[model samples]
Target: MYRPLLRLLPALLVMLASASVLAEEVQVAVAANFTAPMKLIAADFEKDTGHKTVLSFGATGKFYAQITNGAPFDVFLAADTETPAKLEKEGAAVSGSSFTYATGRLVLWSAKPGVVDDKGAALLRGEFKHLAIAAPKLAPYGAAAIETMTKVGLLPSLEPKLVQGESIGQTFSMIASGNAELGFVALSQVFEDGKIKSGSAWVVPTNLHSPIRQDAVLLTRAKNNQAAVQLVAYLKTEKAKNVIRSFGYEP
Candidate 1:
């Protein structure tokens, strides 16, 4: 028994040394709309690669401002393609490292069982006092919401009832908390395993608004960080894509 234990010690030490050398921590700034899926992905990434992720979720516009002002984020996952492209142009992100991570869907949702109709006629009916949406200037989902309302010819009529949230996460919170009876939100927020997890919703047609092509990029600050590179690569993996799809996003 003593001889076996002595023989195993070298292998155990080698394994420990490998783990210590390979493991690293990466800081990521993610869009509010991608929060749920990102959390799951981050967990899986850490488990598989022995790397840790520090995630921060918020409005893409705010993240852009922070990144340009020298925020310490190693990676940026934006809610739209433009922000990442802009960062690349501005030299804040590594050029050619950007790619579309997901295509988001919009939904007209209500926490209550029947407040929202399947066809989303509630907007025209004007039954609710407040309709929450993210601030269009700050969030791609909010801009899509505006476009949908316009396409349905309800913007002018429903403008008075519109309530703006600083980010999509806040808008979802408003609807979930009953502060707004119904609102426009990302499908991922209320969907799970091929259906809305709770409440009622009408999936907004893609034709109603410009496509929401969310993109991810490696930030210049982490250009040489191995963990950052691994994280970006991890997002493109089949495991990550599956998680994204489970959250109702097209990966």
Candidate 2:
């Protein structure tokens, strides 16, 4: 028995070496709005494929600027389809490797349970002195919020009360910290288990603004990286779709 075990040790060592060689690390730039779901998905991706991920989250516009300036990201998960498309046109991303991964939903949320009503009438009521919103130029959710307010004819009157955060993450932080009584934010930020995790929110109707189509793409720098390719493929899998859905996104 000792002799047989000794003979198999060399083969087992070779197997371990091969496994280590095959595992690769991917660098991913994720949009701030998709933070929660992407964290879960990235973990699942690593566990399932034995690959590692290095994720960086930020505003989509800033990411776009960074990518153009040679950011070393292997993959990009953008808050809108336009950014990826622009990258593809500029030869900064792998052509034909882009796809919409999820459609985001916007919400009017307040940290306090009863501050916001089901129909989102709080804006009109003018009870809150300050309202937080992401910078429209930096975040798609902020643009949607602008559109919603404009369509509802509240922009002019509510302009003075608006407090702009550089990113949706910051906007959510302001509301959660009670710096702003309420704010427009990505539904994913406040939603979990098919409902709002805390506070009250009015799910903004999609018709009020353009559809927020989030896209994922393989960056040109990682064109030949196997792990990067696999990560993009993983985003399309049913397992990934389920995770996207759980965060109030339509996958």
Candidate 3:
């Protein structure tokens, strides 16, 4: 009886080892504007998959620079379609592993309610002294902001009032702190899906500018990583799609 029990013990130990392997953590590089939703999604992902996420949120441009210089990232969630495409083309991202995971919408937001109207043209009118927007070079939302301004015919007129932040997160802080009366931030910062927050905001029309296609790509370095595969599978599910939509992004 003792010898038979010992024989079964080896199989049980092997099962335990397999479970530990499935619980490994994956590291991810994501865009700063996704911070809130990523936090929520990561929470759900861990619960569902028995895996962990080590997320780094920042400007896509900076993330790209790091990955190009050997940043140890297993996955990249970029703010723009172009960044992911570039990485794939350059061989830093696994070919055919890139896809649009979410669509971004920009918003003109103010800490004080009624300061901006539905059209948000008031932002260009400069009723406020300073307007905080992310650097167009670093953030897709910032590029959208610039294009929106140009389309509204305010680009030339409102140049002086513009104050660029390093990333959309900084832009949100500037407006939230009232350091800038109004700013261009991701719609997620001002709204949760259909729920609008306190403050006047214009959900910048997607047709007003180039579509902000947020793309996700598995890094070439993660080609053989099971954790990374788990993350990609988890993120493409209905559960992840709902989480992304809850943050005012189009899933």
Candidate 4:
């Protein structure tokens, strides 16, 4: 009986150690514009590593607030690089673990067919009574939209015509619901059939706006999670890059 007990004790201890090494599932706050690509990548990561992702999608600025207040997110995928850097500086993010994952594009879109012309000059024409845009103070895409308007000499004229939303998703909704005749939104939001979908849009010329360098960073909350490290590594892999590009983003 003593010999059997001794053998069983060693096996039990080994099993416990194995349990200890099992990685914790990671929680993520993702920018709304990145929703499509992130869904695909998360599925692949789960299949490859047996790790899990719990994601919340919305404006990057709002997520920053939750994280700063000690929300449980273990990773952040920001719509712009600035917030990630700020988080790192503030000790909320892990140093040296941040990287740009994609570059985003701006578009002028309308859900109503023929309401917008192919070239998007219709915005300057002020044909629409209301034009929706993301709030420049809360979302980087909003900043890009304002920059685009200023570059094209439309800011002064368009400023009064603009309606602001708190996030990209809300901007899209304003356009879709006809609350605003057209809106400035992320290009990915209008994608369909390997190209821009619905009504009409002008892919805002890249030179008109600051580079929309979207970034991802590990948070201090997930410092010890092997799954988070592995997932970040995977984002740089060709598999993940392909998915991002397919969603109309550039790596």
Candidate 5:
């Protein structure tokens, strides 16, 4: 019996060693629009690979500037493909490492019921005093929102009522907190399980704005990090895609 137990101990030790060897922790900077889906994907990634992730959520433009200034994130999930492409050109990210992870949709949302409608006619009614939007210079969702309003001929008419947030997450908070009665926000912020969670929303038509192609890249700081590589690949997996879809993003 002592000999049998000794034999099993060797195998157990090897298994523990393997876990220790594979358990790498990656630091990820993610776009605010992707916050909800990323939380789910990170949990699944860790469970599936025995690795771990530390996540920071913010606007892509700010993250870009931070990475350029030597912020130590291992990976970046940006809200626009162009941002990652620019990072690669600037040598801030691993060459040839960027890929589209999801395409986002913009929505006009209100925390109060009946405050928004499918056609977005509320903007024309002038009933609302404040409208929140992410800053166009700092967030792709905000740029798209501006484009959407311009297409619908509401840009000039609605500019006076606009309130800006640093990021889409902040914009969502503004609307959710009643600081803005209605706003343009990422669909992922308000959507869950294939429907809007609590707010009244008008999913802006895709034709109204350029497609928001979100991309992820392995940062230069993580060029040789196996965990970062695994994470970027994981974002392309079916499991990750499902999570993105659950938040109403196109994966």
Candidate 6:
């Protein structure tokens, strides 16, 4: 019996070795606005495929510059379609590897109740000392915020009171820390379970800006990486889509 058990142990060891070989660790550069949902999606993907995703989150424009300069990222999830498309054109990304993963919505959010209204009249009222928004040149949501303000005829008046964040995540942090009374942010950052989690928010209308089509692409460096390929495909799965939707993105 001891001899037979020993024989079985060898087979088990071989199986374990094969499983280890199948697992891959992938490095991903993700948009700051997609942080929460990406965390959930990464967890689910790892559980389902035994693959690991290491994430770096920041402004999409910065990621674009990094990828162009040979950053060691396997994939890029950008806040807007244009950057990914540009990467593809510049040969930094694999040709035809880009696709829209989610459509984002902009929202006016205030940590304090009643500070923001459904129609976003608060911006016109000049009630807040500092209004935080992402830097328009570096972030898609920031550009959208500017577009919204321009459409609503509030840009000039609000410009003086604006506080700029390098990324949407920082913008959210500012509002959460009470550094800014209210500001424009990705709807996903403040939304959960089909509702705004802890703040009064007004969903900005789409007509105010170009559709925020968030796209993902495979970097040319990841062309031969099976783990990177698998992770990209996993993002399109229904499980991942559900998580994205829960975050208020149209996935």
Ranking by lDDT: 1, 2, 6, 5, 4, 3
Ordered from best to worst TM-score, the candidate numbers read 6, 2, 5, 1, 3, 4
Every candidate's lDDT: 0.95, 0.95, 0.88, 0.89, 0.93, 0.93
My TM-score estimates for the predictions, one after another, are 0.95, 0.97, 0.93, 0.90, 0.96, 0.98
Compared with the true structure, what per-residue lDDT tens digits does model 2 show for residues 151-237? Answer: 999999899999999889999999999999999999999998989999999999999999999999999999988899999999999
Report the lDDT of model 2 for residue 242.
96
What is model 6's C-alpha RMSD? 0.9
lDDT of 1 by residue, 180-220 (tens): 99999999999998999999999998999999999999999
Instruction: List residue ranges in candidate 4 displaced over 4 A.
Output: 1-23
lDDT of 4 by residue, 178-214 (tens): 8999999998889866887677777787999999999
lDDT of 3: 0.88
Output the lDDT of residue 201, model 1.
95
Spell out the clash pairs found in candidate 4.
Answer: none
What is the C-alpha lDDT profile of model 5 across 179-216, one tens digit per residue? Answer: 99999999998888789888799999899999999999
Off by over 4 Å in 1: 1-15
Model with the higher lDDT, candidate 2 or 5 = 2
- Where does candidate 3 stray beyond 4 Å? 1-14
By summed lDDT, the worst window of 10 consecutive residues in model 4 runs over: 15-24
Better of 1 and 3 by lDDT: 1
Cα lDDT tens digits for candidate 6, 1-251 = 59998889989999999999989888999999999999999999899999889999999988888888889999999999999999999998999999999999999999988999999889889988999999999899999999999998989999999999999999999999999999999999989889999979999999999999999999999898888999899999999999999999999
